[model samples]
Target: MKDTVLNILVDLTGSDEVKKDLDVNLFETGLLDSMGTVQLLLELESECGVDAPVSEFERSEWDTPNKIIAKVEAMTNEL
Candidate 1:
């Protein structure tokens, strides 16, 4: 799950550094913007079976790679 989320983030951010730093603030670094977040949610749903709605997305909760992975894991577990 961690690897899958990281790959999505890396592809979204276009940075290999996302894989290197789990705690990196994707928003602050300008790696991920609002547009990227929407795309991330789509990828998460399609690739990992995580069906989190856009309305549930919160930047504070999903800023880092680890957090995003955790979110995906939590959402998937709910199913």
Candidate 2:
């Protein structure tokens, strides 16, 4: 599951560092922005069956690889 999420991040941001630095702030580094985040949510929905609405998304909650994975895990549990 983590690998799936990581691959999506890498694909969306084109950042290999996302895999190495789990705590890095993706938005701050410009690796991810609102558009990319939306795409990420779409990917998560399709790939992981975790559908999170964009309105409920907070940058802080989805700012890093680890945080994104945690958020997805939380959402997946809701399904």
Candidate 3:
């Protein structure tokens, strides 16, 4: 799951370093933006089958890879 999430982040951000730093602030560091987050959510749904709705995405909840993985795992379990 971590590898998948890391891969997704790398692909979306075009940054290899993101895979190494799971806790980095993607937005604050300029690695991601609002539009990127939306694209990421869509990618998560399509690639991982984690359908996180845009309405429920809090920046704090989905900021880093660890948090995103937790969210996706929780959502996947609920499915």
Best by TM-score: 1
Report the number of the highest-lDDT candidate: 1
Off by over 4 Å in 3: none
The best-first sequence of candidates by lDDT reads: 1, 2, 3
For residue 11, what is the lDDT in candidate 3?
Answer: 89
Higher-ranked by TM-score: 1 or 2: 1
Q: Look at candidate 2 and tell me the lDDT of residue 17.
A: 94
How would you encode candidate 3's per-residue C-alpha lDDT over 45-74 as one tens digit per residue?
888988788798999887888788888888
Residues 18-70, candidate 2, lDDT per residue (tens digit)? 99999999999999988998899889889999868988798877788999888
- Number of clashes in every candidate structure? 0, 0, 0
Candidate 1 lDDT at 12 equals 90
Residue-level lDDT of model 1, residues 1-79, one tens digit each, is 8888888888999889999999999999999999999999899989998887888998999898988888888888889
Give me the runs in candidate 2 sitting further than 4 Å from their true place. none
Candidate 1: stretches off by over 4 Å:
none
All candidates' lDDT scores? Answer: 0.90, 0.89, 0.86
Cα misplacement distance, residue 35 of candidate 1 (Å): 0.7
